[model samples]
Target chain A: MQITTFSFKRLLIYPVILIILLVLGFTVTAEKQPAWFQQAQDEAEQDGYKLITAHEMKALYESGENFTIIDVRPEYEFREGHILHANSLEFDLGDKLELKSDKQAALIGLLGSDKKQTIIFYCRSVA
Target chain B: MGYQNVLRFPDGFFGWKSFFSDNTQSVDTIKKLGIGDVFPSCRLVMLYDETDRAYLKIQSLQKSFALEDIGNPYLYIVIYNEKCLACVDEVQSFKALYKSLNESLYLSDKVKLLAIGAGSKKRGVIAFKKENAIPYPLFADENRSIFYCLGNPVLPTSYLVHIQPDGRRQILFVQQDHINNVEMLIQKIYSLVKDMELPK
Candidate 1:
């Protein structure tokens, strides 16, 4: 009887150890998010910019909604390819929405004094 | 800045192109270059000098070189975009590999490193070369001719080609994405080419 009891306990402990090891392996192999990713999330929240996916953007484009889409990549990249009806406005690296005086004027010109206009800005990636 | 209902498309052009079917002819649409494929012949304009400085226009730097002209036993072609920050960041890893090759007595003379800036103009290429202090030869593919010829690969694609004495060439290895570890890659290439005869 004692032998059977010990055998049962051993089986239970084996599974328990296996489960612990699996969990540890997963934790070790899990990819850690980059620092910039978290910072971008925080900035988006603080700046009140809504993040939309490609599908959502497609839906918005197909819905014919009265919205302005701007391609904020470099001129060459914009020339290479961009979404339909998206205006070109190049932004330097890491200069999200920080437009210079002339660029600000250009943005104002594209936006046309309407504070309620639905505007969207996109670049090479979310970064 | 005062727009209240502003939305941001995080996926940008690449994601949009991938999801939707539009008139935009993106480079990603083309098939990626893979192993067992012959490297395409394209003209590459040299933009940077040996000292890593941008060559002035008056320096008469309009000369271009063909891929077939580089007579090295092994050629490491790194295709990158100067405007792409991620691509620029990946250059450090290539630099490490270059340093390793230079340090290796056997591979130093046999391997040649070359960088092609896809969709990159001379000015941007110069600035990128200067900023990174890249020691390798930098070429600008402003019109993306070479990029298109190579199947419009994703930014930071590297191809390792083995050239034979009879002018036959074949891609030996390809790294289509960021290389996380240089040491492992060095060891891998070393093991692959350790027994190969050096070019005469």
Candidate 2:
């Protein structure tokens, strides 16, 4: 009986070991990919979007061009000083995660959940 | 909408020029601090975050290197620890630049190193702690008067200025990143001094 119990415990070990290895492998792979924002240009390729500077926004505004302006700063900072009519779409710094569900929903409502639009993220500085 | 060629400001008004309006200091305020002149008695200030590691590194440098009697000649070191969210290697690398500058410049009491904390996510301490940091005096400037005074808000930077005999100051050099060689900083200081007709 002791032998059978010992054999059962051993039988569960390999699967657990395999599971650990897979989880670790995936996480390590993610870390190697660099931060999310650094991948902006690459993500831009996946979906046609562009990263712009604060000065670029000024020029576009003066030109009267219609491009979506997403303000990725915090709500307080957004309120303190930001471009007029700029939709606040705060994302994580390294592909920052949106903190508020309402904010996230508002972003979807404004930009449309549609994956394609001329989305330009601008804040005090590009992370 | 009309489109303009999008590259370079073409030497027109931009961010660099905007910093000038802060009205912190004027060129005519002093005789333009020159080389061979004693370092100014300006106080050191920082807008450092209490929890930042890089800020701590710089603080450590200040504590370790602060000298009351380097005596006859000196420059002040002010570190702006405002937005110090850099990687460990990036922070560690600054020490190398500091050492290089110190070794090459024949830096005596004539040069002072000052760092300004540039950006911050929080109210007080926008800067962070990093791997290794410079050895020198550091000062804080929350409103960025010095930054606007000198107009070099670029991050991870250092500047050299000549404090003229008559107390006027002129910027001799400004370095944005490790890309700037320290030896060049020395050369600029020497030139600014020579131009000011001061003894090198």
Candidate 3:
């Protein structure tokens, strides 16, 4: 069989090119969730933290466990129909607020310099 | 995968009839949210997509979702799903539960109460499904994306979208409980709405 120069080069390089492309594709596809997500999820699990449900929260109230309820919604909405005693922690879902000052103010305002309180923070869901 | 922070009451408040009977009250002041036209600008989607989602120092959890639409006021009601509200006996009176739990639905004058529905998703479908929730926005985010963005879906699964005073379409607020955050959602709504109105 006679091999033309064009076909000859195609045969020699095609396999190598294909192999290289596949390697690159595999690397990119493997990277999915951001590192922060894994970190948050891991921290929650390792620390034995639990995400309480609304019903569970109700139980705590029924049990009369002393704890703070943080309502991380808007000010106006807080006035509407908030949990019995949950405090307001107004925030935007897509926007980031300045926590540097808010945190200090919040601690003083809610706990009154007492960081030992069993502060249970809850928003709209288990985000 | 420890889904510790997850709970599913599917039915919010409307389903747990007996217990919720005395606890639940439908408000007529709740109003419809959002403009009838296209969805508003993206600025109002003031979501916190970081590790510090709950770092805000606001006083109420309900603030995250409610808004005081100035020009054309809209009302949003937070529907507390019964089964989702408590663990039956352990949680005494729903009213005696939280001293600080924020629910944005109570803040009014800017919005009105069209109606409030709670219970299981199964029953809510028959009750709230006909309210024209096309994208049937419920709080049950199987992927956890919705909760991740909103900080948590404790009470009030999802907020009813509404237009703000600035003429931008946005989510009004929700009534979450955390079975999927049934009642607390309204609190989140208020904050989210104000964030939308924030200057830049």
Candidate 4:
């Protein structure tokens, strides 16, 4: 059987085309972030959620200020080490912070549990 | 749902360790730390090479990899991690101070320096050290056992430890939080060490 150079070159075209398509697809997907991200941030802002730094939080804790700290990290991470007196809740699935339908009610219940309390959500690092 | 107020601790647990001391040592602990107060030393994990790793047994301002190994006595120990942005700057400043003071008393053999990266994996810290071009030997404490052992407190804490001729370990000075000026810090450390040597 004679394997021509032209035939070998033709065989390589399939992989080349596949690689180009894969790169283009990856670029398109990478450039676009999750649709729910901006919506969530807007919702949080509309709900009067304010951002605070760790140093400020430390000062508040030192002064004996009353505040509810919600740890949004995983249960295992919370168990490992979390802020003192902070409550833990897993608000993530895989990589997305999707508010699953079942968990929504529990979240609402938590928010409504304390009417006069100030609630703050905290994670390892804010991004 | 709307909430009244919300705040986040950006620095988190690591930052908290830098700001406050554990039950053993409170915020006022610094004032109480003098010649007689013994500095607790523990064995901490450190990354030396790609494959070879060992536990750094730090006790009385001395460091050793193995129990039978001879501990290298250092004049000071700087505990930091890659997570702390300020620590990066602090390390750079230390390098600058070290170079600038090469011919001075501050950078003499009498003042041996050792840096330890607390609570970070070896891989991450290695990259950090490489990028920073850190002149001093860097160690990684993958497990925060050393932090807890030292009683969790603020990070980037520098201890000026002195091993007297009589083999007594005493802390001459302790600097907490981010240091902006390395020269000033070196001066301060020198003055503190000199004060310790002064007769009462």
Candidate 5:
């Protein structure tokens, strides 16, 4: 009975320790991120927008999907070079991090009347 | 605003450019305009103006303006991209230069500052103008027609043109880079314009 109880305690204690270590590892990793990146991630989460990686974007582009890829960079940059098939729709972000009314309208117009469409926007950087 | 499936690529264009750097084409395809080249005439849709709106159609509210319309002897044209941060800095620098030029007795009347938004649309240009508080006129080249006509030069490319009396524009200096030193640029413009005999 003593040995069995000891094994059970060992199992429980080992998982608890492992769990604490895992949590600590995750916390440390999160803390290591830059403040700007954390803010961006939080804002994206709140805004319900998903963040994608370059490799993921490339994969999506190659998938021949029906999604829309919008390049929000300046026209000159787009002209010099850009991802193939990406549409150029330049719009300035307002002080409140919102699109101007007219720009919103233009965006809607370009996006057509479909709200369910998968639209991706990119510029010079994450910011 | 209700787009449920919106996504953002954090890597952006720079990442894409880097990944495909090997596939990048040469910039030699764009013919860089040199001094003395006649500034080509291309119709740009006027998006925002501080003074007056040169409306092309009263009903459509589609205002247009050409480089030739400005009768100023020395025209400083800055081609920029509305979303480009560097271009914004360049535009602000030009704005400061324009203000200084306006204050000057000799260069004020002879010079006119103009900005062309390469591949920018009406809404984008309007927002940019309002954000920058630009005093001069800003036009939108939605289709990049003017940009292509000017040999698709680099962003924020500035051209100082001497408009001849015979209605010809001679490119005096082409600044293919950003204005790092505004004072130097001002002095450069002043020296270039001060010695020239104004067409009387």
Candidate 6:
């Protein structure tokens, strides 16, 4: 009876080690991606969206067109410098769950929940 | 009716400022602050010791910190907080303006410049002042009564206060958002001072 119990404990240890290794591997893989790529990936997962370039943004501004620009960089970075009229809303790289709920809600609130309204999220750069 | 358009400046203020450079300024909006607008009485504090983070309330700041010190004829630049990019940029402009005024023989001491940070507590005010090396008296208005006084104008607004000889103060000019042109602002202040008939 004691031998059987010892055998069961031994069996559980291998699976637990494997599970931890798997989690660590996934975490490393996620961290390996560039910040912009990760942000894009997370954004796509939340809602289909494309990254914007500075020049394109400049053109848009010059045209006097209306669009919502949200700066998802850190507040200090935004405070140091940002595009004119951009609102600073920092994105948590660690908080994936919040990306879909709180952030989305904030974005919707800023530009209205309308599907057609253009909204853009920005960091330092895509490249 | 539903709103039609919405947009973003992804490059942010940094991009806008870089694009405009010294030629032109891209501002959110400009609201005019005129004379006779009184600042609401609010709790204010100033740094007493820079080394130890000690503070003294404006009400008990010093005998010298009177109505005249608060403003009889002063440039009171009010900001929301350090997080305000426009406000930070404007503070840099104010620094430059201060340096210029100090160097100018005629305009020296023509008007005192003081900055008030509405909604900023003592710690936040101290941090901002130290970080920016703001060479002016920065007071923290925790209750934001002063902010509410001017109809809660957007961050980084400047008010030209005309303090009479009798210490009667009135708001003379208010510049909302970025000052745009430093030269133009100086000229306007000079003109305003001339109108006030204060010693130039």
By TM-score, the best candidate is 1
lDDT for each residue of candidate 1 in B1-200, tens digit (9 for 90 to 100): 57777888776777677767573543224566688897777766655443322211123334665655564678888988876777878989999998998898977877777888887788878888889988777888888887777776757788887776666667778887568899888886777566555454
For DockQ, the strongest prediction is: 1
> lDDT tens digits, residues A1-127, model 1?
9999999999999999999999988877555433445665676799888777666777776788889989887665676678888888887654544557888889888988678878888886754
Chain A: TM-score in each model: 0.63, 0.46, 0.51, 0.52, 0.65, 0.54
lDDT of each: 0.74, 0.44, 0.41, 0.59, 0.74, 0.61
DockQ of 4: 0.15
Please give the lDDT score at residue B169 for candidate 6. 64
Off by over 4 Å in 5: A1-127, B1-28, B45-63, B198-200
TM-score of chain B of 3: 0.26
User: What value does the lDDT take at residue B178 in candidate 4?
Assistant: 61
Q: What is the interface RMSD of each candidate, in Å?
A: 4.2, 11.8, 9.7, 8.4, 3.5, 8.1
lDDT: the better of candidates 1 and 2: 1
TM-score of each: 0.63, 0.43, 0.30, 0.50, 0.54, 0.51
Better candidate by lDDT, 2 or 3: 2
Separate DockQ for every predicted complex: 0.34, 0.02, 0.02, 0.15, 0.30, 0.08
Indicate the residue-level lDDT of B93 in model 2: 48
Model 5 interface DockQ:
0.30
Better of 1 and 3 by DockQ: 1
Worst 10 residues of 1 chain B by lDDT: B51-60
- What's model 1's overall lDDT? 0.74
Worst 10-residue stretch by lDDT in candidate 6 chain B? Answer: B51-60
RMSD of each: 9.1, 16.7, 21.7, 18.0, 9.7, 17.1
lDDT string for model 6 (B1-200, tens) is 14333333344444445556432233233333456765443434446434212211223334234445442245445555666555776787888776765565655556666677877787888888888988766877677667656655656677777666666567787777466677777778777777778456
lDDT for B100 in candidate 2 is 54
Clashes of each: 0, 41, 132, 8, 0, 17
Instruction: TM-score chain B for all models.
Output: 0.77, 0.45, 0.26, 0.63, 0.76, 0.69
Which of 1 and 2 is the better model by DockQ? 1
Q: Write the per-residue lDDT of candidate 5 for residues B1-200, one digit (tens) a residue.
A: 68889998766776677776543332235676868898887766555442534321112334655556665778888888876666876776888887887888877777777788888888888888898888877778888887887888867788998878777888888997667787788788888887666454
- In the range B39-130, model 2's lDDT, one tens digit per residue, is 33343333432322242333443422222322212232333443333222244445554565456545433554444443332233322432
